[model samples]
Target chain A: MTPPPALPPLLDLTGIAVFALSGALLAAKMRQTIVSVVFFALVTGVGGGSVRDLLIDAPVFWVRDPWVAPVILMIAFITWFTPSRWWEGKMLDWADAVGLAVYSVLGTAKALAYGVAPVPAILMGVITGCVGGIIRDVLAGRPSILMRPELYVTAAALSATMCALGTLAGLPLFTVWAIAAVAGFCLRGAALIWNIELPAYSRDP
Target chain B: MTPPPALPPLLDLTGIAVFALSGALLAAKMRQTIVSVVFFALVTGVGGGSVRDLLIDAPVFWVRDPWVAPVILMIAFITWFTPSRWWEGKMLDWADAVGLAVYSVLGTAKALAYGVAPVPAILMGVITGCVGGIIRDVLAGRPSILMRPELYVTAAALSATMCALGTLAGLPLFTVWAIAAVAGFCLRGAALIWNIELPAYSRDP
Candidate 1:
């Protein structure tokens, strides 16, 4: 009858906030209205986790939590009122990397706690960490991030796989989660720093 | 425990097949590979119902049914192999209309059976019918059907509302479902025939 170990409140909020901000930033780039920005932020912030919750038959995390929606809306508002120039930097990419890493591990952990198989649980982690951005990009009428030759999903998969393996090996929760998240963050950081990309399918082929 | 009253197999298959075909048709229009066509077909066919199932905490519909995936794949294969000219015409529209109406009523009924409230259940119905197309359009990198001035989601809403109302009034399941679906079909059919559209938001105001 023990409760599952949860991600710290600050950490969870940081992940949600960063993702929400990224969504709003896309809206801003498109020069959409505030309403569209808010809508985008909400969807991108909640999309992945919502998909994961539904698949795992958990009551949707945001629907049950009071703070998540309001926090996303606040992030959207900030994105709206602030000058776009302030958001144009490598800082945004770094923040997004953190969110991806954290959410990936958390998603994998939650899926495992629900008794999902290891491989599917890892898939759940990727879904939780990345589906939101895909949803946002789609709504913005752009190519999905996944459609690009990027390390984004690969980073999430790495974190999820690490977490699943760590849990299976009966490692302590702190060690497992830290290593998983840091490993993902490091890989994503390298991609960003080095302008790395996966090879695209050759059109000639 | 008694089993839930299910939509007839033929009817369900017809809806799934038509939606899957529409999805594959879009892929073909984009000149994507057969694999992309099949992926699009499966996603568009199951997207809405999967969302409803997740929201209601029901085991995902397609995963449980052995027939659904293979049928969708067959539809995709047919679409990929056939000349696009064969799929051109009012027939595709007509089939889509049938799928929309049938899926909407079925979604509402399933939600109600699962103890969802009337308003949310009606929304679920609409989600079940239209979200597949939305997802398809998004993945295809086109404007969402919802963003257009057309009467698509509105038609779905009409059907869903009618179904909810009929159920609330204690009408027989068959009558309610038929009336609801026909109402939606007629509206959508009329839109298709007459090229009806809702007024777009004017920015000049």
Candidate 2:
């Protein structure tokens, strides 16, 4: 199903907006047309959530809600009109980190509400936070998030795990969600500041 | 929802098996471990259908069926054990073309059954035939089907269009499906033999 409708709409929107912006930015960087920018935005904004909804047998979030498409279109328009260099900075990364953190927790919470098992629910969260970017990268034929050794997915997993654990421990929903999001954001931020990376695999056994 | 339950089981399975084999063969070619092979097999086999199901708001086929996972695992094992040279030829291409054709028709039929409009249903058919390989290529960091000028997606689109048109013309379901499948397969087969391709995009206005 969709993210809990009760969550404040602002936080719920952060992920899609940031994801959409990233997709639009990628399209712009490729010198593509407005059509491509909008298409990329729509796909990135909805892809992860759509995948989660399908897995959980819930109606896709965008289909029922009219606002989602319009929001993506607006984001795409802004991206198309703005100079691409305006997006070339650390601020964008920070925004994406915030989105990743909040979305991971939100996805986990929704999965828990739907009676999904804790592990899979946590996975649902990571998938929610990461899949949009992956799809965008694939469509653009760029090196994707998974190919990098960065802390992106790990941060999402951390948030998802924390959300699942906190809920299992009988924590209040708002507190658990806030803490989980912060925890993930902190990890991603630290990675950004320190250039942290996971070790690459080696074939020698 | 899942390709019309009334259809015979063998036809229903042809698409997934061929897709799974392609995924496994790719992994085997890459000299990946059995774990990676199985994962690839599962993802490629179900990826397209899962995407179609999600879009159409239908239950994912493999999630409900116990047989799907085991069959993928079996395919993975067979791929892993076989010598790589065994698959170095045109026969495999023919097999994949069959999968593409049948899956496109099945996907369109399922979407139409779910009350999706004709145009979107046809797109769904193409998506169901192509998304699995696209996802696989992305994960493997390889050149995807979309980058090529070949007639792969076109064949699928032709099948989907024919199926949609046939249904709209009051043709019997079985007749529409069979004819559409054969039409797509023949096109793809001809492409394989004669190297047919669509015109490349040009920058000139």
Candidate 3:
């Protein structure tokens, strides 16, 4: 069988770095120890991809990757030394939006390459993009994004679904990937700008 | 290459039912709908073991087992119809302690059977006993047990360590399992009765 399609190495590292930064920043803001910051960064960097791999019966990516842990550690050190306020603006969110889009699309592509069905492959992508943040919030004893009727998870689902559909339509691989990434990034970026939120069930309108 | 030791089917079911009940009961107490209640039961019932299986590269148990889903669904139905007050006493805690101990031991045994090293195998057991509740609490927007300076994780760790040590010492599997479960349950039981908690770092006592 042909090897599964690979995510571009630079984009993959950017995703992990972006995620690690968010986790480390949270810990630093909370005045947690350097160890906690590092631990948080490590989990957030790898949590989503790890869970996706597990669900898809694939080898866990970070366990074998030499660079993943070091990248997370470096992120932690950066957070530990820097003022948390430096990360408290829209810049981090924008970077995270990009990471979410890229990872979700690529994760779906990888799952599809591994023979997963479209629906599950899309869910796999959603898991790959969103689970790390959920884990970080949980560990920090903060409200998880999943608990909010926000566009975050929706953005991930959008990217994953788009990738699955594009593949199903026999679109060119790189073109589909680019479109899916841009679509998700745009939605998430819009959410950050407008503070968009889905109405709670109680609102119904 | 002997097949990995099988947890007694009855005991396995009991552990799952107990965990499922805890999750369902939590959702029910919060006045969540039947759908949420059932979803909680499903996650709590299989969360720990699923993580363990994934980490060990074993096929996920519930994904293939027809019985597990049915049991969790049954638990959801039971919780939905029952008054939440009916489970308000310490009885549930006691039952959860048993489930924790039994599952932790069995999880470690299975991981060891998969040729996981001692330390990671022990951690597998703790993950099996604890992660379901963590996921449930996280999803519900509640402070998870991990944030508490409680004996819950400690009990799981003790049982897991005991199992690993016993196996290393060449003891009979059944005897080791029995001792590990009892040790863990007893510690957890004592914690409940005494309202025991570990000292926080600041307390340092």
Best by TM-score: 3
Model 3 residue A55 lDDT? 81
What is candidate 1's lDDT per residue for B17-119, written digit by digit as tens?
Answer: 9888888877776666654566578778888999899887678776436578678879988887678778777867777788888889989988888888999
In the range B1-205, model 3's lDDT, one tens digit per residue, is: 3478877888888889999998898888889999999999988889999888887778899898879899999999998997777888875677678878988998989988877767667767988988888888889988776666568878888899999999999999999999998999999899899988764322111
Interface RMSD of each: 6.3, 6.2, 6.6
- After TM-score superposition, the amount by which residue A77's alpha carbon in candidate 1 deviates from its true location, in angstroms, is 3.8
Best by lDDT: 1
Q: Assess every candidate by TM-score.
A: 0.61, 0.61, 0.62
Writing each residue's lDDT as its tens digit, candidate 3 over A68-183 gives 65677788888777665566677667767877898899889989988999999999999999999888887888788899876999999999999999999999988999999899
Candidate 3 yields a Cα-based lDDT of 0.83
lDDT to native, each model: 0.84, 0.82, 0.83
Q: Which model is ahead, 2 or 3, in terms of lDDT?
A: 3
Weakest 10 consecutive residues of candidate 2 chain B by summed lDDT: B196-205
Q: Where in model 1 is the C-alpha error above 4 Å?
A: A1-3, A201-205, B4-46, B55-57, B61-134, B143-205
Per-residue CA lDDT of candidate 2, range B1-205, in tens?
A: 3345376677777678888988898888888999999998988888988888888787788898877788888988988988877888875677678878988998888888887767667767887888887788878988777556678878888899899999889899999999999999999999899998865422222
Query: Between 1 and 3, whose TM-score is larger?
Result: 3
Clashes of each: 0, 0, 0
Show the lowest summed lDDT stretch of 10 residues, model 3 chain A: A30-39
